[model samples]
Structures are given as C-alpha cells and as structure tokens.
Target: MLEMYRSYLAACNERAWDTIAEFLHPSVLVNGIPRTREQYVDDIRKTIAVFPDYAWQLRHVVQQPPWLAVHLHATGTRHQDFLGAPGDLSPVETDEFAMYRIADGRIAELWGTADNARLRLSTHNETR
Candidate 1:
C-alpha cells in the first residue's frame, strides 16, 4: 500500500492524469460527500489550471491497513485570478493533511484540509 501511495503521489506530481483513475475508486467520498472519480479529477484540473506550477511534496505518512494519514507540502505560483486573489502573485505555499480510506486496493474515501490562511496571504501579498 505504501508503494502504491508513492506511485500515486508521483503520478500527481508529474501531472500524469492518464493513470490517476487507476488509483481511485469509480465512486469516491470526499469530506463525507460522495463524488465520482471524474468529478474528483476535475477539481484537480481546475487547481492546475490556476496554478500551473503547483506541486505536492510528501512530507510524512502513516499507513495502517485500510487507513492512511498523510502530510503534504504544496507550493504553486498564481498564474490566474482565484478565490478573490489577483493573478501573477508570488508563490503560495501551504501544508495539507489528508486521511484516506482504502477499499479494494484503491482510494475510496478522503478527508483533507490545507492551510488556507497562509495560502490566501501569499496569494494576496502586496509585496509580491
């Protein structure tokens, strides 16, 4: 499972959308809300559109059977307006924590949160 997770993260960092669905269940739940795998992938597409250089770096992980807890550091430069922030802003850095529920060797559910305050501040920073 750990090796699978590493491959998943690598695929994400490489923007390898073609292989992403292989790691996700056809139906996934995020934050308690059910979503199709396509919907989940679309959300990622939107983010990448806004931050073309965005990348997620794995910092830590703990896997115990069907449950996995992950810590990631994400960074990206704002190339377009997003969430009330102007475009061409400085790089935005954020930390995200994610909990995943694995079912049938695929990611079936996820609960995650990021340091949005810091991300917003970086995006809206005037000094940039």
Candidate 2:
C-alpha cells in the first residue's frame, strides 16, 4: 500500500495522469467533493497549466487499516495568469495534508487541505 502511494505521487510529480489510473478508483471523492476519474485528472491538469513546475514532496504518512494520511509540501512557480494575477511570479510553496480511504488497493476517497492563506501570500508577494 505504501508502495502504491509512492507510485501515485511519482506519477503526480511527473504530471502523468494516465499512469495514475492504476492508483485511483473510477469514482473518487476529494475533500468530500465527488469527482469522476476525468474530472480528478483535469483538476490537476488545470493546476499544472497555471504552474508548469508544480510538484508535491511527501513529508510523512500514517497508515491505519483502510486509511492513509499524508502530509506533503507542495511547490510550484507561476508561469501563467491565475486567480487574477499575472505570470512569471516567484515560486509558491505550501503545506498540504490528506486522508485517503483505500479500497481494493486504489484510492477510493480522500479529504485534503492545503495552506491556502500561505499560497495566496506567495502570490501577493510575487506581485508586489
């Protein structure tokens, strides 16, 4: 299971959404928001479109039967306009955490949160 998580993260870092299909169920929930497989992939795709170098580095993981909690440090550089701001901004880094329910060796559902305030601050600082 841990290996699965690692594989998933590696795929995510590479922006290889197709490779991630093996790790995610067809129907997954992210932060209680139901998302189809395509939708989930598109969400990340949109993010990468704004920050071409977006990456997530795992900080920690806690495994309890049927559940895996993850802590990660997310980093990216603004390469295009996003959230009303222009591109070429400084790099962005934020803390992110998620709890995922594993079913049949795939990620069935997840609830995750990121330090949005800090992310916004990065943008604010970059603009000034």
Candidate 3:
C-alpha cells in the first residue's frame, strides 16, 4: 500500500491526468463529500492552474492495511491570488496531511487539510 501510495503521488506530480483513475476509485469520497473520479481530476487541475509549478513532496507516511496517512510539503509559485496572498508569482509553501482509505488498491476515501493559515502568514510577511 505504501508503494502504491507513493506511485499515486508520483503520478500527481507528473500531472498524469489520464492515469488518475488508476489511482482513485470511480466513486471517491473526499472530505465527506462524494465526488466522481472526474471531479477529483478537475480539483487537481484547478489547483495546478493556480500554482503552475505546484508539487507535493512527501514528508511522512504510515500505512495500516487499507488506511494510509500522509504528510506532504506542498510548494509552488502562485499564478493567482491564494489564501489572501497577492498573486505576484511569489513562492508559497504549506504542509498538508491526509488520511486515505484504499479499496481495491485505489483511493476510495480521503480526509485531508492543509496549513493554509501558515502559508498566508508567510506570504503576508514577505509583502511587508
């Protein structure tokens, strides 16, 4: 499961849109909301559009059977305003944590959050 999770992240970093369905179930649940695999792909696409150079670097991971917990360092240069930060193409970085439930070797459910407040603070400070 750990290796598979890593591969999933790899595909995301590669912006492999066509391969996303291979890592996510057709009926995926994200943060308690039901979303189709295409919706998930759209969400990723929107984020990448805002942060053209976005990447998620794995900081930690733990796997317990069908559950996987991940900590990631997400970084990018903003192409548009985000988290109250000006869209001056400044660098932004944040920590993200997520727990995933895998079904049939693909992610079926995910609960995740990112440190947006910290990123906002850092960006605000930089503008000072």
Estimated TM-score for each candidate: 0.90, 0.88, 0.91
Stronger candidate by lDDT (2 vs 3): 3
- Clashing residue pairs, backbone N/CA/C < 3 A, model 1: none
Clash number for each model: 0, 0, 0
Q: What is the TM-score (0 to 1) of candidate 1?
A: 0.90
Q: Write the per-residue lDDT of candidate 3 for residues 1-128, one digit (tens) a residue.
A: 88888898998999999887789999899999999999999999988987888899999988887899999999887888776876777777888999999988999999999887655544445553
lDDT of each: 0.84, 0.84, 0.87
Candidate 1 lDDT, tens digit per residue, 46-128?
A: 88888888899999999988999999999998778876767765689888999999989899999999876665557445353
Candidate 2 residues lying further than 4 Å off, grouped into runs, are 123-128
Clashing pairs in 2: none
lDDT of 2: 0.84
For model 3, the superposed segments whose C-alpha errors exceed 4 Å read 121-128
Q: Indicate the worst ten consecutive residues by lDDT in candidate 2.
A: 119-128
- Candidate 1 overall Cα lDDT vs. reference? 0.84
Runs off by more than 4 Å, candidate 1: 123-128
